[model samples]
Target: MIPPAFDYHAPQTLEEALSLLDEYGDDAKILSGGHSLIPMMKLRLAQPEHIVDINALTELEYIREENGVIYIGGLTREVALEESDIIHARLPLVSEVLPLIADPQVRNLATIGGNLAHGDPGNDHPAVMLALGATIVAQGPEGKRSIHINDFFEDFYMTALEPEEILTEIQIPVPPQGSGGSYKKLERKVGDYAVAGVAAQVTVDGSGACTSAGLALTNVHYIPFKVTDGEDVLVGSKLDKEAIEKAAGIASEQCDPSNDLRGSVEYKRAMVLELTRRALRDAANQARG
Candidate 1:
């Protein structure tokens, strides 16, 4: 269905966008790639009185590495992340997950900032970003501040971003030497949201022990959850099958999965255990090599 009529503004400057938000207040919606917002509006689930388009803000689209951090501009398209050499070299786990999300057509138009800020429980990045411990930078009437990815999602379709705030960048700290990361998800079809998804990053010590680790799961709660209990099981351990099984059990048992059209809570919980095991194993393998 066609979205209801709404005023549109193509603002070239961030200041203009901020002013527009102040002018329209809660009635204004920021438009990024339009991949998620347009569909919601089309279904009448979202009805913004004013749509502030930031497409013309060329300054916000970039991928660059500096000071041992990979800084991705908020407007950077998913296709850009897929093709980015710096991302591939410095952040392969994010790279792996990028193409796994949706399809090339959707990726070409989707932005990382929009994906995380949308606060969809099933979104790929929020879980992965939480695992990677990434930071989201934003601008607002008061100025700028950064938030951890884990803290960004508040509840169903809700986020920590204030109505006056605009997410501007994603910053990932460089992993330690010999670190490896990976993402895995189980979906009913290609390009669909995961029935259960996992992302993990592990760093091994020279003594063949886990030094640091991260684990996150998707589609099991109102927002992504960091599998801290599971990670604790892996870190400082050899990550054998027994260890992985226990870790998976911890995650599966801890997740607050609910019955949904995708699957019964029982089925999703079982899948979570299996997927988390696979993700943890793969991430450990990456770190070992």
Candidate 2:
């Protein structure tokens, strides 16, 4: 299948890209790494009248730390995140999960902004971003604004981004002392979307009581499911078997999986429970250490 004919514009600067978006409005689609948009275009699931290519906007391609937050450019590739020393040291969960997303070839061309902006429930970064309490920055004709991860994802293939807005960066706060995180995913095979995946981040006090916790699931709902009920279960206690089990149960209860080739609804729900438990345990252990 071939994509519909469209006008193409490669903008070298952010302002140039924004101007194109302003002109095209909803008729245009931003092309980042082209992993998601190109596929949808080819399948005719998306038929934009214009394609605004921002790959040449080098200003949006960086990874840096500022004021206790790690800022990743919208065009930053998954492979870059996987290999970033800053990410490995400050956000191990990102380094751990990047490899689990598709394969090396896909990661090489996939941008974190594209993955999140596409609003696919199967994408790995949304759940991890939720678990890390990240924020996204978007720029438009009006100006730049920030959207929290909790509010950014609205539905399947839907987000808070206006048609003319472009996501510019992702911001992740540095984890607190004694903080640790883990991502556990169950896929049909390597390089496949997760059947069920869980990302957990735990911060424990010196006495081992959880101070803050985040739990999120992927590929099991219309949006990346943030397990607030499950996170509440861990926040005031040690992540023991009983607490973990209860949290897992709560998380599993929130799942509404469809019967797909990867799994039956029941099977995916079960995997969610198991992965939640394992992720929580590993995160708790790391937090304690």
Best by lDDT: 2
Judged by whole-model lDDT over C-alpha atoms, candidate 1 comes out at 0.88
Q: After TM-score superposition, what is the CA distance of residue 107 in candidate 2 from its true location, in Å? A: 1.1
How do the residues 1-289 of candidate 1 rate in per-residue lDDT, one tens digit apiece?
Answer: 8999999999989999988887888898999999889999999999999999998887889999899998999999999999999988888789889978899899988999999889888989988888888999999888899998878888888999988889999999988887888888888899998888988888898877988888888889878888898889888888778888988899899988878778999999999988888888888888888
Model 2's lDDT to the true fold? 0.93
Give the number of colliding residue pairs in candidate 2: 0
Task: State TM-scores per candidate.
Answer: 0.97, 0.99
The per-model lDDT (C-alpha) reads 0.88, 0.93
Every model's Cα RMSD, please? Answer: 1.1, 0.7
Which structure among the candidates has the greatest TM-score? 2
In model 2, the worst 10-residue window by lDDT is 53-62
- lDDT per residue (tens digit) for residues 255-275 in model 2: 898998998999998999999
